[model samples]
Target: MLAMSSNPDSPRVLICDDDAEIREGLVQVFERAGFTAYAAPDVAAMERTLAAKGADLIVMDLMMPGEDGLSATKRLSGKGAPPIIMLSALGDDADRIVGLEIGADDYLAKPCNPRELVARARAVLRRGKDADQPAKSDSVRFAGFRLDVARRELHDPDGVVMPLSAGEFRLLRAFVERPQRVLSREQLLDYAFDNDSEVFDRAVDVQVSRLRKKLERPGIEVIRTVRGEGYLFAVKPTS
Candidate 1:
């Protein structure tokens, strides 16, 4: 079942949870916060709502009777899908990391403050809106690699396309845009993630490591780590 609001101009948020009370409560909260909110009882209904109405963001339960949130989020991971925030009873750091690595834009434990969830949603929406602004170029070239800004794709010098996760794409884009400059973890986080995201410096390091592996060559070092500082994009990029 789906309940929707009439405000077409407001941001659209889809809340999916098996618990009736939780779903309805979130719907009310988002609506009161000036969003055109929709509610779905399960993953199936969530998909239907997304296909029919579209959404600026998705707030999904980590556990459900049929398709779980992790599986569904992995399935939906891509360039154009709406950002997702996973709500789970498992509040451990490992669980949150798993959710993020699987493609959720953010994760929150259940029984959280509704206001915090709303704030996180707004932060994610702001990041999405910023990304949608027109770029000086559709593609950027650096160190025998090409990043397709519009499509969020990366290509090696050999012209083979390298697959990147959403986080990896954002991290790489940040690096390529500011080549030859040392960027602290905080700075990278500001460039690559929502300002209010709970991601830590370790998450930034992990993303940089993953991007480094993809950009690695036999003897060519593209990203250089400065001792006691941060990482630097060793080459200049041209758009």
Candidate 2:
């Protein structure tokens, strides 16, 4: 089932939850916050709504009947996918890290304050908008590789395109932008994710590790870990 509110000028948000009351309540909350909100009973209905009427953001629940939110989120990971804020009863640090690693932009535990959710949505949307703005340079080159900021693509020295997840891309971009400098996990979180995001330092480590694997080559270290400090991008980037 899908319920929609009409507001052509407002940002569109799709709320996908199994609980009817929670779904409708979210729709109303987003509506009051100036979003053109839509409610979907599950991931399938959410997909239907997305195909029929594109959304700016998606509020997804972790547990559902057919497809769980984590699986759906992993399927939705890619360029142009709408930002997702995951809601789950499993509120442990491990669960949140898994959600983020899979692709959710933000994770909120169940029974969260409606106002806080709205605030987080606005912050995520703002980050998206900021990312859409024109960069001073179209791309940056580092360690014989090129990062196309606008296209969100990375090409190796051989011109082969390497696949990067949303989190990996952001973390890489932050490193390249501030190459040759040791950046603390806290700083990386601010640069790579929403400043208010509840992501832990461990999540940053995980993303950095994944990024290092992609940028890996024999005998060349691009990112380095500084004991008792943080990580540093070993090479300087050229615009």
Candidate 3:
């Protein structure tokens, strides 16, 4: 459930689109919906705005005059930037798949319904809000992957502590605390990031894979697929 703003303030949205008309229209739509919106017509402005301050969400266009949204999305993935909803003229599944692959949380075709856009925004944010929570502790060590919340770190038998991005830490923590529970993608996103994204379940899978690689246990047995279900932390955790 979305919470009422403490002071009736609006969310801050950053809009990056080469199309001036589209950018302005989205700004108007979000503003009318009680969001403070900022627009950037190109990638350069997008960078500046993103670096200047964090935003609640970023609305970006796929095709641009300069570097495309796909490339920008890659950079955002590396930096773990704000949750994004991409606007693309391309309606192909491959394009959408690529967007998801690179970490664009949501993808919307151009000329979408304003009402739907707002709903998407809220839904994404609702997920984001769920991330603020930390899962209950059950103490897990699978193969060689170990998560210790008191220290906020994961370690191998070699004592090498892998660095965790905030999101990675939370996701891994959730699994460690609930080993063997086949948590759904939506559940993991909410667990790891405070319920803030419409991020694809695949993104969660990718993050888990990345964590698994870092842990590097035999057969990569830490995280296992349950098919039809989401994923499970394979080892039974202890106190």
Give the winner by lDDT: 2
Clashes of each: 0, 0, 13
Better of 2 and 3 by lDDT: 2
TM-scores for candidates 1 onward, in order: 0.89, 0.93, 0.72
lDDT tens digits by residue: candidate 1, 1-239: 68878999999999999999898889899999999999999999999999999999999899998999999998886646788999999998888878887778888998999999999999888877676555678899888888888877788999988877667777787787788989988888889895445887766776788789889988889999998789999988888
lDDT of 3 by residue, 54-108 (tens): 5788888888988988888777753546777888888666666667656666778
Error of 1 at 115 (Å): 1.0
lDDT of each: 0.85, 0.87, 0.70
lDDT of 1: 0.85
Off by over 4 Å in 2: none
lDDT of 2 by residue, 66-156 (tens): 9999999988876567889999999999999899888788899988999999999998888777766556677999889999988888999
Q: Residue 206 in model 1: shift from native, Å?
A: 2.6
Clashes of 2: 0
Clashing pairs in 1: none
TM-score order, best first, reads 2, 1, 3
**How much does candidate 1 score in TM-score?**
0.89
Give the Cα-based TM-score of candidate 2 against the true structure: 0.93
Model 3 CA lDDT for position 108: 81
**Candidate 2 residue 150 C-alpha distance from true site, Å:** 1.0
